[model samples]
Target: MPDIISIGEILIDFVSMESGVTLAQSPGFLKAAGGAPANVAVAVSKLGVKSGFIGTAGNDPFGRFLKDTLNSYGVDTCHMDLTDEARTTLAFVSLTADGDRDFVFYRHPGADMMLRKEKISEDYIKSAHIFHFGSISLIDEPARTATLYAIDIAKKHGLIISYDPNLRLNLWPDEETARKTILSTLNLPDILKVSEVELEFLTGIRDIDSGLKALKDKTSASLILVTRGIEGVDYVYRGERGHVETFKDVKAIDATGAGDAFVAGVLYGIHERINEFKDGHMTSKALQDILRIANACGTITVTKKGAIPALPTIDEVKRFLSERLER
Candidate 1:
């Protein structure tokens, strides 16, 4: 049985090396395997966990490349669906002077968004300890309903549900629809991971405290992880007070996939029974250990490039932690 099952989009990212350039305008572009759920699967696999990914991709070369990449990373691709009707989703990412990213999507209801309810295997959902999903699958048709259906089955089977609203604005037709739909699914998740900007945009609350409260009140999720780039992470449980921890500084080459790497670390810690978050209480020591490991994973990912390719192994993470401790 797989330790974790991630269900969502699987696609290719065409990233520009230069600023103010689109895929067409850039002098050079790099093709990399991407998509949030795929990244999470790679992250989990890199940490020595049995992880599986379930999503649809075209029968095209890009889709084949993605599947091959996932298998090479040790992620089980048995559940991946391939169809010839639609092409693979493509993301064109442009970097700013300060390393911030802007995305342009080339999607006309791609294969990932065409996932059908019949394609979701019962054995796949029941065989996993955790079921993770993202917002992209909620943007479109049969896939929207299919994703929710899978979540319901996973919850009924007593699997822990994890959500990451890795929001992409360009994909959604309107902000209100995206906001409403993504907010509605919050209650179904046991753990929700959101970036600072995502929290603000989701709740319309500028203050972190207020935003956190608003999300908790709305979703009733006992565990909430809020990631702040460079400043590390802050987490909140039912009775425990939230706290922020800073991480050691490193020369970050690319910020892609850092959050997914952190999520994988937390999941690995939970799976190994290292630091489990209780129903109503979480100890500070436990939280600190979780953050430390997560920070190490995130830091290691930034030192590399790409999303799935950047995920660090368990030994790499330990080595990073050891070096940082010595410093």
Candidate 2:
């Protein structure tokens, strides 16, 4: 059985080769395995944790490649289903003039979105120590039901539930629908991770403090982490809050999987100290240490390109932290 299980979409990302160009203007595109929950599972597995992925993939070469990629990273995929009803999800990404990403998605009932509730295995979910999910999969039917059902099983097994909105505005039919659907199940997780922008989207407050306060008022999640680009991470554990500063003198090239890598680090820490968190006992210093590891993992990810490729292994994270300490 795995220590951690992440459930969501795992698909191919077609990235344009040319910089500062749209997809039409790009010379060519490169294929990469891209998905938020899968990235977190891979990152956790890479850090020497027993992580597993529970989701659906298309019955195609791309799906096989995705499975192989996770296997290469030492992530378990025994429960990852492959469906023939729909093709895999695809996202075409290109850089704009200002270095911002412009994305176009092709997921009209993608195989990942076809994850049915009947296909979900309660046994697999019960076997995991922690459960992680994203908001993207909750946009539609079968996947939405499947995700919630799995969460219920995880809860029954006393597993820690971690949620990250991982918002993509374009994927939703409307902002109101997205906001309503997400908040409807917001009270499920023990941990919630979101970016500053996602915080605003969730609570309609731009300020992290007020946003977090509003979220706490709405949800029962005990721990909430807000990642502030270069500013660092602000976290509220139980009732106390703290901040961890971002590493200085670091040059971030591609921030593709930075957030996932950070989440992986946090999950790893929780897995190691599962009893403490389950017992509702944690010190401010202990929480800060977890955030520091997560910050380093994100820092390492931003230094390289791609999601899974950029994620650092356990040795790499330790080396990165040790080098920083020496500096």
Best by TM-score: 2
Residues 12-119 of candidate 1: C-alpha lDDT, one tens digit per residue: 987777765555677876789999999999999999999999899899999999999999998999989888879999987776544456788888879899888998
Clashes of 1: 0
**lDDT tens readout by residue for model 2, 5-24:** 99999988786766677788
Error of 2 at 229 (Å): 0.8
**Model 2 residue 218 distance off true place after TM-score fit, in angstroms:** 1.4
Q: What is the lDDT of residue 94 in candidate 2?
A: 83
The C-alpha local distance difference test score for the whole of candidate 1 amounts to 0.84
Ten-residue region with minimum lDDT total, candidate 1: 273-282
- TM-score against truth, every candidate: 0.95, 0.97
Judge candidate 2 against the unseen true structure and give its global Cα lDDT, from 0 to 1: 0.87
For model 1 the local lDDT of residue 154 reads 94
Off by over 4 Å in 2: 96-100
Q: Rate the local accuracy (lDDT) of all candidates.
A: 0.84, 0.87
- The alpha-carbon lDDT assigned to residue 264 of candidate 1 equals 88
Against the true structure, candidate 1 reaches a TM-score of 0.95
Candidate 1's displacement at residue 182, Å, is 1.0
